[model samples]
Target chain A: MTDKTPHDWLNEHGDYLYRFALARLRDTHLAEDAVQETLLAAIKSPSFEGKSAPRTWLTGILKHKIIDIIRKQGVEQPAEDMSQYAAEEDPADEFFNERGHWADRPLAWPAAENALEQKQFLSVLQRCIERLPPKLARLFLLREVHEEDNESICKELQISPTNAWVMLYRARMGLRQCLELHWLGK
Target chain B: MLSCKQASELLSQSLDRPLTRRERWALRLHLWICAACRRFGRQLMLIRLAVGKVVAETEQNENLRLSPEARLRMTRALESGQ
Candidate 1:
């Protein structure tokens, strides 16, 4: 394969890299900075022997860049208020009755098959993710989107293992309900 | 019998880690008897699958892109670094 110039790299991989960062950072400026830094680092590194696809190599660099930003931001930002999560009134209460049975039975989603191939379905999913409470969205994205392990997520968020589990459960519950309402038409 | 609330939490937790044998049995039993909880579990699994697809497609998604200004700024930065 022939060598591509910096301009070529920017034209090809810029948006993909930017979106990858934006999903994790949730800040447009931070995502832009990350993509810029990743590209710059890729340009400077001597290790690109052209063995792997350029996008894959660049994504490898971008992943580390994202981790660094998450670590740095973790220190700079104050701990998120988790008291609401610890309250006695569980969010799950909305779905369960006094007997702990489903207050509203979940309807089977017949449309779920091949839904991923539909752009509209994906956009609805994205909207549901955006609608999530900020803390829940972050935790969900870290675990599901970035594929971070539970231990590392708890450490990064300064939450205990139990809290992490509870938070993740809440996130999934929220997303499931959102999809059911909007996409499943329930 | 595990309540639907408890069983649902276990279903979500099972995504992240291995469940204890007792927890697994309780969940299985609940799922066996509870159609609603079974539907919930299936939907949760579908959501996970959908999320994986969404992440993969975000790269090629036309709606999500770097602004032209950001792209130009990145280009200038790259050029100066050379």
Candidate 2:
């Protein structure tokens, strides 16, 4: 490959690699570092076999770089307790009576098919997710974004299966409520 | 009888883990009569689908790019073998 190949990689794959790292690491600085390390490693390697797509190969390297960071970080801080999120306190109460019937039924949302196509919907969704408490947000993403299984999520966050379940429930409830108030209002 | 609260928790838990036969039966029975819980269940599914789409869009969007400083630093490191 020519000298321009590295520059080409930088131009083409930089943002993609950065986002992959960010999603795994969730720290902008660490994500940037991992991207740099992956590109540097790719450049230093003896040959490019072109066996897999270049982006895939780069991502594979980036994944390892992220794993190293996770390992070095060792035990993550315990996920925030579910009680800290206000939504957990009485989420059911708002919608259900003491007898557990619907006291205040959820409003009918606009057709989700139409809503998904709106570009603003995602921004609203993202902001709602950001509003979640830090640990809840992480757990939500671990399941939804990373598609990690429950066991891995518990192991990574140092929480029990029960805690994981409660937190996830809270996160989902919180997001749905936030969307209703902020985004889905007609 | 499973109230809406209990039934809703069952629905959310079903997404994370399988429901027990008893829990499934209870939730089913409650949902049968409660139009509100039924609507909530459908909304939950929509939230799951929409979240998946937003995450895909997030991965592809240009908004998450590295800063110029980081990009330049990475480029220089690659070029110089440092």
iRMSD in angstroms, per model: 2.5, 3.2
Q: List the residue pairs that clash in candidate 2.
A: none
C-alpha DockQ of every model = 0.67, 0.57
TM-score of chain A of each: 0.73, 0.66
For A56-175, candidate 2 gives per-residue lDDT tens digits of 888878766765665455423334444444455565567568887767677787777887887777778878887887545656765775555777656655567776677677788778
**Relative to the unseen true structure, what is the C-alpha lDDT of residue A133 in candidate 1, on a scale of 0 to 100?**
68
TM-score of each: 0.82, 0.76
Candidate 1: tens digits of C-alpha lDDT, residues B3-70 = 99999999999988789999999999999988988888888888888887776776666798989899
Q: Per-prediction count of colliding residue pairs?
A: 0, 0
- Candidate 2, residue A102: Cα displacement in angstroms equals 4.5
For candidate 1, write residues A67-179 as lDDT tens digits.
Answer: 66665665222123345534666678899998998888897776567776777777888889888865466667767766567787667656677767777887899888888
Q: How close is each model in CA RMSD to the real structure?
A: 3.5, 4.3
